[model samples]
Target: MPGFTKHMYLNDLNKIKSDFSNYIKNIIQILSEEYNLDSIMYILEKYYPYECQILNEKYDYYCLKDKKLIPLNKKVRYLMPKPKSIIRGLKITKKILSKTYKDNYALNFDKNLQLENEELLKKEREPKINKIKEKIDKAKLKAQEVEPSFLDELMGLYERKRTTQKDKVYIFKELEKYYCLKVISFF
Candidate 1:
């Protein structure tokens, strides 16, 4: 009921009508083929089993109640039934086809609604995400603009002293005391 509205039902019925039209056109095309009655019967029996059943049962009841061998070609008109039987068959087929389409449409409708909601949420969050990104960028830029502190310079010097000259360990040991005093004074 969520996705199945009156408009949807009407649209589905229109589509089924078009599909039935195409089906009738195909049936006419098949009948127009130069195949024999046996081949025709085979095709009808294979595809339009319900129609064939109606035709056989009705014709037997109406025309061939007593007779055993009812002429296949003449007893029935084009291996199809009268208007009433054809309409009944179409109604049944339409009900089935419409139900199938409605079920499939309902399933897809939920997925589509979820996808739309996800997209909307993404859109709504985009500005906040951009603001956060902008703030982060400004922080990075501010950090870059600020000069290095004495502690950072001292750390750099210590690293260079360790890598460049292992024998200059005594010199760095003396500088370490001065560096610690400077750090304490600054803080």
Candidate 2:
């Protein structure tokens, strides 16, 4: 019922063929505009098998066995009930190409890809994150090891003349040394 239409099956192929062929042509046009024919053909080749499966029954009845979906053969394809929607072709094409569609990348409309990409990113970021944390830990240790004499000198600068630009530079340097204020520049 997913791909089959509510309209009577008059054994006409021209109407559906026109739209189905149009869908393929549109896909070619869209892809070819951005990529070479080889890439387009590769994608179409990868997707062509599934196209046949959709023609049988996309969302509904399918020959299943042993907890796995069995692709319907040409023999049983017509035995099943037809899809009850005329828009099935477009919907199927959209769903099929939605993952490969460039706009869907920005929209995050491909649910499966989003989850997969998120997981991959987390895995990929783990080592970089650990490296950052190690760097931060090293900086903290360095800050803590600052000599007490510098602290007294910093206090004297602040107490003697807190408003001077030179005092500010001295105070900021000490703060950076002791507190690990990474980047600071006056003037």
Candidate 3:
């Protein structure tokens, strides 16, 4: 722990957080479906006490993949000693070096690790880029087909025919008949 005194320890904080995560996972497994935030808090209080935040932040474990923390009929049935022992071990070390504990070291480590993991995930997701591009191209083609320009020209021609054809030569023949009838009545 000397080389990892505090500042130097931060260099590989991500690894430490990963280790802690594994440790938490293992602890949860031992408890089975018998684990609850309240009970876990009690154990932490009885042992390490300082890491009680783990119990208080139940939301952190709400989506836990570990079987131990999973609920069964709203009940937790098993209790184990590994987590208490782990917490106790850390508590002793943390108390001795309270001033130099630098909890932020762990926090910073977790942050960096998460960022690195995200970068890895982003790389894994790189292939989807092509799929998105293909979708965009398809959409553009569909939009162009939705409104063909020739329809507008056809519509204009139909409108002109309807309005002007009404006053065309066919109407003149009817008017001539009306005039002849009017002359016969006058005679």
Candidate 4:
């Protein structure tokens, strides 16, 4: 059985009471087809005479089966089964309830409005990072692009006069590009 509630029924009743007369009329038609007109009419008159008056004012009517509000809206007309009948004819074989998990954006609708903002920020930073990387890569590429040559590995070696530290410095040229190799701090 589809769950029924007073709040849900009242909301639908208020909708029918406010605008759209067709909803009431459709329920009345269904009631006239299934039960005695006076019995259905008496039920409407007893509990919801105001609704009946609203229908009468608008040349409409309504009916109730059990306590469910059977609105005749085209979208929901076929859903109104008889009272006490289970809606088992439905072909549903699977039922799952979604679990809720909190996220940073869950409390902020604005965060979802700008999913592209993070992506855009990332895209914006990528080019700048790439530009810096390219400069470093170009410097290395230019060094490697030069013609190959060989030079003496050790033209000189010196030890500091005041300290035992070797303070080694190796300077050389490869393909007209100078590279400074220094042993500043040894592990």
Candidate 5:
């Protein structure tokens, strides 16, 4: 009997089902449960001399054959014809020309170029004029508004009390104590 190797039997079980006879299928199925259909197909197409034969017009009426599978059709080699290039013997060349003259052509070409620069300078000076106007407006507003005296508020917080001598002495003692504590903590 034609026997398959362990690796072959394990990997080509599905191929045997599709390509081989009932005897070969049963033998492969009984020999191993693990089979990779894609790897087996790849091996058959790439390594082995496999053949497919159409028995009838129907798609189902087909047979596959190899050394492991049932023999069916004659060996037919299919070759893809070499592709022909349409643009054969074509050469591409690029030439970049640079002006050799040293004279400034841009100034000669545009008469209004100096006028454009003058306009641009005028436009640049507009922001400075606007800034001066804004400063004058701010000065005018400040002149109209009354300013609050922060010094007056600070002086009021430290103003002396018109109390009796005993009360004044007690207040001065408390102030001295608070200042001493603050200075010690700061150090």
Candidate 6:
């Protein structure tokens, strides 16, 4: 409590998980049936912000890893306590003078401790990183595949002649004319 006073006794400030990414698979299910592109984009946008926040927090945590974060005292001496205990009506000064209480001191950053802690943190982050990667890879595979419905016929035409964009457009136009049908250009 003396060292880490933020939010009372909290030590680590790292966020455990992304606020929005937990339901991305469900979001995808409700979107495109084939590519699920809308869901994929949702995951990307939400995941990126969470990644950035995590990176920022990690940066701040290691910012002073190699530098001194607390100043060391030139001499150790306890300032006499003057306040009276509320219930006992007696001075609460003995603890400060105790050897055990006085032994605590701050110093330059400990590189060994930092490395040990960093290794442990990497272990904690590994599974989350792997899970996100798997999710993104799955989304990539879905986005790359052809959609069904009307797109299947369109893609069938597209697949027959896998040529350059210009050639494909020309070929499709030629097919349109040969079939005596008007081709609508979505572009």
Model 3, 75-153: lDDT tens per residue? Answer: 4322222433434445332342244433433333454555565465445434555565587577556443233444445
Better of 1 and 6 by lDDT: 1
Each model's TM-score? 0.22, 0.27, 0.20, 0.25, 0.18, 0.25
Off by over 4 Å in 2: 1-118, 145-162, 180-187
Give me candidate 1's TM-score against the actual structure.
0.22
Candidate 4: residue 26 lDDT (0-100): 28
**Highest lDDT model number:** 2
RMSD of each: 35.1, 26.1, 31.2, 34.4, 43.5, 26.0
Instruction: Give me the candidate number with maximum TM-score.
Output: 2
* Candidate-wise lDDT, in order: 0.45, 0.46, 0.39, 0.36, 0.32, 0.39
Q: What is the lDDT of residue 107 in candidate 4?
A: 36
Ranking of all candidate structures by their TM-score, best first: 2, 6, 4, 1, 3, 5
Clashing residue pairs in candidate 3 are: 32-68, 34-76, 34-77, 34-78
lDDT of 2: 0.46
The list of candidate 4 runs beyond 4 A from truth reads: 1-105, 109-111, 145-187
State candidate 4's TM-score. 0.25
Candidate 6 lDDT over 21-63, as tens digits, reads 3323223222222322333444334434455454344444434
Model 1 spans > 4 angstroms off: 1-109, 145-149, 152-187
Worst 10 residues of 3 by lDDT: 178-187
lDDT of 5: 0.32
Clashes of 4: 0
| lDDT string, candidate 1, 126-162, tens digits | 5755676698577556443323355555546655735
Candidate 5 versus truth, CA RMSD in Å, comes to 43.5
Over 4 Å off, model 6: 1-50, 53-106, 145-187
lDDT by residue (34-83, candidate 4, tens digit) is 23334435534543445455544322222333323435433332233322
